[model samples]
Target: MKVGLGLPISDPPSLLTWARRADAGPFTTMGLLDRIVYDNPEPLITLAAIAAATTRIRVQTEVLLAPLREPVLLAKQCATLDRISGGRLTLGIGVGARPEDYLAVGADYATRGRRVDEMMPVLRRIWSGQPHDDQVGPIGPAPTRVNGPELLFGGFVPAALKRVARWGDGYLSAVPVERTDPLFRMVEKEWGAAGRAGRARLVGQVNVALGPDSVVEDAKQTIGSYYASLAGTYDVHMVTTADQIRTTITGFADLGADEVMLYCWAHDPDQVDRLADLLA
Candidate 1:
């Protein structure tokens, strides 16, 4: 099972330093979260910076809030990022649940799920160099992989899963492996029902804050704030020791996750090396 790093999108000085460190680490991929009502850096633009600084690590958005942005422009920006990243982009998207995020972007919070359903086809149409009309798509430069980045969707809702079956390349679940297994099975059935021939990727996320016990509270607080108003509760696993984290990851691997991205809650870049050493 491949392991990726989910680094925080912080202020320039700190984020750049951490991005560079992650690039040089043993991580196979590096990703970020998105928010409109928060102070977090923009995922696509930050991904562009990461692509310039790294050669091997895949650059991804854990899940970009697709409904908040205009679909065409979002597609253009993502394609450009994919090009810049040398095709190392996995575009995970979702209808962000935060009402404030939708309001901030002037998007219809109630209709976001439906908007996402419409957005996918438009994105794919643009990426495939086939527009429905002159104003709609077939936008200039295409994505690096030809059909845009690896499209993945987040959420376990029935409608969301139907959208995945229709357009997504995989499922990005920010849940534990135990919860992910059944979802993967459902995804498989949905894919087959949708007439899709291939197996969708299952990317698992586990919030981990390793290091001394002192960092646990700080990690929880940071995660809590980041997820404030977005989720009912924020769960940042305080893996106090290397042995504990290793066992946790092995459990995820055993659950058949195609890849697992570890969301690091520490601010320092040295934490990257520490986790790498532990995983080594």
Candidate 2:
């Protein structure tokens, strides 16, 4: 399976440095996460910068909160970014988990799932150069690819999984194999039921913090604080050792993952070479 490196969004100033290092490393793609309520930079804008800075690796949103943005404008931004990146963009989307993020944007948190379902088609329509109803012109600056960028659907709900067959190009799982195995199977089953040819591309995620004890401890605390306010107990698997990383990647490959992103939580750029040497 291919391996991607997820850059840390906590430190915005060092992002390009990390991107530059990752671009020269043994990584296929670079990923970023989204959160409006958090201190992290916006995924799309940051990814645009990363795409411009790097020539080899792809830039992706690990999971952009789709229901929070305006569909037509988002379509335009995505199309522009896709072209700017020379078609090296993958838009992973989901109806987010944090109610605070929705509330901050004045989006109806209760209706997010429905909003995302409605938004997907509108995004495609805009990307196809179709004029909005009663408007004289269509959205300008077409995408690099025929129908905009590749879309990977994220989230653990049944409706979320169904979206893979309905509109997405694949599934993005943020959990480990023990939890993600059945979900991937369900997505494949839905793909077949929906008469989609071939199989759904399955991408997996693993949170990591590979470095000295101080860095690993800081990452654990940061992760805990960031996720402390959620409804239930938030338990994320953060593989710290090189052995753990190897074993985790192997496990995902066994589960038939197309690509597995190492979602590095440590803000240190040195972590890039650390992982590169291990993967090499």
Candidate 3:
């Protein structure tokens, strides 16, 4: 299975460090998460910077909340990032959780699912240089990857899976690392019913913080704080330690994951290096 790292985009100042390290490492992709109401960097802008900082590791929005932004603007930004990265971009889209985030962006949370469905065609048309808003012709410069970056859809529900079958080149499963099988099966079934040929990419994700016991606890606390809204609702293991992380990833790979990205939860930039050590 391929390995990827989720950049702690909140740590903007050290992004270059992480990017260079990622480029120098045994990593397949450097990814970002999307959230409007968080202390995080804008995914596309950060990727543009990383595109300039690194050359080898692919950069991606592990799951950007596409419905929150203006579709045309989103298309341009993604296209530019793809150009800057010389086509090394993977795009994952989803209607995010967190109603407060949609509220912050003035987006209608209730209709985001349908809105995203609408935005897909708009994004594709704009990415292909086709213009809208009464413009004369095509939009900005085309992405290096013909039309745009490869797309993956995130969200585990049946409705979400239907969209995944419709638009995604892959399925970015958001379920916990352990409970991914049922969702992956759903993806396969949907893809087949949609008459899609070839294997759909199965990407698994996990929140992980690795270090000594004390550092581990601190990392777990950080993750807990990040997902506090889900607290007391469901059980989740705040992964810590190299062995645990390895087992988790290997388990996902054994279950047929094409790629697995560990959400590095520790705040320190050194955590990147530590993760490299473990994987090495």
Candidate that would win on TM-score: 2
**TM-scores, one per candidate:** 0.93, 0.97, 0.93
Q: After TM-score superposition, what is the CA distance of residue 104 in candidate 2 from its true location, in Å?
A: 0.9
Judging by lDDT against the true structure, name the best candidate.
2
Score candidate 1 by TM-score against the native: 0.93
Comparing 1 and 2 on TM-score, the stronger one? 2
Q: Residue-wise lDDT of candidate 2 within 116-140, one digit each (tens)?
A: 9999888888788887668557886
User: Candidates' lDDT values, in order?
Assistant: 0.80, 0.89, 0.82
* lDDT tens per residue, model 1, 213-271: 66666677777777766575544344556787787688777877788888876666677
Predicted candidate 3 versus true structure: per-residue lDDT over 139-257, tens digit per residue: 78699866678999988678888887787788887667778998888888899999998878899988777667765676677667767876776456657768888998898898799
Better candidate by TM-score, 2 or 3: 2
List clashing residue pairs in candidate 2. Answer: none
Residue 220 in model 2: shift from native, Å? 0.7
Candidate 1 displacement at residue 6 in angstroms: 0.5
- Displacement of residue 124 (Cα, Å) in model 2 is 0.6
